[model samples]
Target: MSEARAARPWLALLAGAGYGLFYLYAIGDVTLYGPPHWGAYLTEVSLERIFTARSTLMFEAIAVIELGWVVWLFSPLNLFLALILAGLLAANMHGVLYIRAHPKQCQVGGNKAFIGALPALFAGGACCAPSLILLLGIPGLGAFGALFGWLLPISIVVLGINRIWQHGHGAPSMLEYARQRFGLNNPSTA
Candidate 1:
C-alpha cells in the first residue's frame, strides 16, 4: 500500500482519538456547568425551549454515534473499517482546513467525503454541547462548544494537511515509500 494508505489505520486511530477527546471534553464541561443563561441573553428564549425532550434525544443520538465511532476506530477487528472511516475523516479534515485556508470552499460536498462528514461533526458537537447547555444551564458550555466545535475540527484538518505536505514533500512519494517499506499498495486509489 502507498505510504499514506499504509498509514491509514494509524491515521484513523489518531483522528478518532482526537474527536473522541473533543467530545469527552465538551460533554464533561457541560455536565459540570449546569445550564446555559439563555434567559440572560434572550427574553423570548426559555430554558424549556432550549432543553426540550427533542434536544435530549438529539444528544443521546450524538452520544451513541460518537461512542460507535470511538469503538470502531479502536477495534482491532475493524481495522479495514477504520481505514475507510479514516478516509472519510481525512476528507472532512481536508474540507475544514480548506475552508479555513480558503473561505470560498464551503459548498456542500465541495470536498466530497470531507464535506459529507461535516453534518455528522456538527451534529456530534450540537448533540454533545448545545443539548447540555440547554438542559444544564452551564456557564462555559458555549465557550467549550466553540473550542471543540470549531478549533478541534480545524486542528484535525490542519493535521491532515500537514500529513499530506510531509508525505508529498519528499522524492519517491508516500506511496512508493510505503510500498517499498511495508509492501502496502495505494489504497487511496482503490
Candidate 2:
C-alpha cells in the first residue's frame, strides 16, 4: 500500500478530532482562557443533569469542566451531535484522500467530498449563537430563528447524503489500486 493509503485512517481520525475541537469551540462549549500552563479539573458532576437542559433551549450545556487554559461546558447531546458531524467529515475527507491516491479507480470527482464538508463548516458557528438571525434585524424573522437550531442536523443530513452518493458512485480497495498501478496482473485472468 502507498504510505498515504496506509495512513488514511490516522489522517481521518486526526481530521475528525480537529473538527470536533473546532465544533466545540464554535458552540461555546470549549473556550481558550488563562495562561497556557494553567489547568483545572471537572466540576459540578451530576448524573441528573446529563439528560436535563439548564434552559428550555436545545443543546444546552449540563456541566462545567475547567482545565485552566481551556474551559469546557460538557453537554452530552451536543458532544454526540459533534461526533456525528465529525465522523461524517472524516468519512468525506477519507474519500477525498482515496480519490487523490487512486484517481483511475474512481468515476466520481474528488471535489464532491470537499463540497460536502462546506455545510458543516458553515453551520458550526450558528449552533449556539443565533446572532446571525438577530443581526438581520428583519421583521417576522422570529420563526426563522428556530432554523439555527437545526443547522447542525441539516449539515448532518447533507453530509450523510453526500457520503452515500459518493460511496454509491465508485470506490476501489487500496490493494486493488496498488495491484493495478504496479501492473501486477492476476495470472489466472491472464
Candidate 3:
C-alpha cells in the first residue's frame, strides 16, 4: 500500500473517535452508558401502542408486519424494537466491518454513521422519550440532546446516501482502500 493509503483509515478513525467522544460527553451524558440510570438505555414497548394495535385477523397480521417494518425503517425503539434494530444494526456493522477488514472486498457500502446515530437518537437524544433525560439535572443537555438526536440520525441517512453516491461515482471508500491494503480478500481464510 502507498503511504497516503496507509494514512487514510487512521484519519477516518481519528475523526470518528473525536466525534464519538464529543457526542459521548456532550449528549451521551444522560444516556445509559453515561451517568443516568442504567435502565435509561433500554426501551420498552409503549402500553398505548399495544392497546392501539389493530383488530381483525388479517388486519392484525398486516399491522404486525407493518409494525415490524416501521420499527426497522425508523430509529425509534422499545424492548422488542431495540432487539430487532440491534440485530439488524449488528448484521450491517458486521458486514461493513468485514468489508473494511477484508483484503478482497473493495466496497464500503454500509453507513457506519448509523452505529453512532442509533445510540444517540434512541438512548441519548430527544427520542429517548422517557424520563432518563429528565433525571439528569443539566437542562442544558436538552439542547445537546435535541441537537444530537436529529443530527446523528440525519447524519446516518446523509452518510448512507453519500456512500451510495460515492460508490456510484466509482470512488473508493476508506474501508475499501484499507481492505485492499491490509485485509485478507478471501472469506474462507477469515
Alpha-carbon lDDT, every model: 0.40, 0.63, 0.37
Highest TM-score against the true fold, candidate: 2
RMSD of 2: 6.7
**Model 3 ranges off by over 4 Å:** 1-7, 28-148, 188-190
**Model 1 over residues 92-149: C-alpha lDDT tens digits?**
4433333333333333232443444445455444425554676798876666654434
- Per-residue C-alpha lDDT of model 2 across residues 1-190, encoded as one tens digit per residue: 6745632756876887888887778667888887644434554557665666632334566667777688888888778877877877677666567765555566545565456546654554455455444566667777766566667667677767665665665543334434654678867887
Instruction: Give lDDT tens digits, candidate 3, residues 65-141.
Output: 12221211111222233333333333333334433443234344334433433442343233332235566666666
User: Model 2, residue 133: what's the lDDT?
Assistant: 49
Please state every model's RMSD to the true fold in angstroms. Answer: 14.7, 6.7, 12.6
Sliding window of 10 residues with minimal summed lDDT for model 3: 56-65
Clashing residue pairs, candidate 2? 39-68, 40-67, 40-68
Of the two candidates 1 and 2, the one with more favorable TM-score, higher being better, is: 2
**Any runs in candidate 1 off by more than 4 Å, and if so which?**
1-9, 29-110, 131-190
Write out the backbone clash pairs for model 3.
Answer: 103-183, 103-184, 103-185, 104-185
- How many clashing residue pairs are found in candidate 2? 3
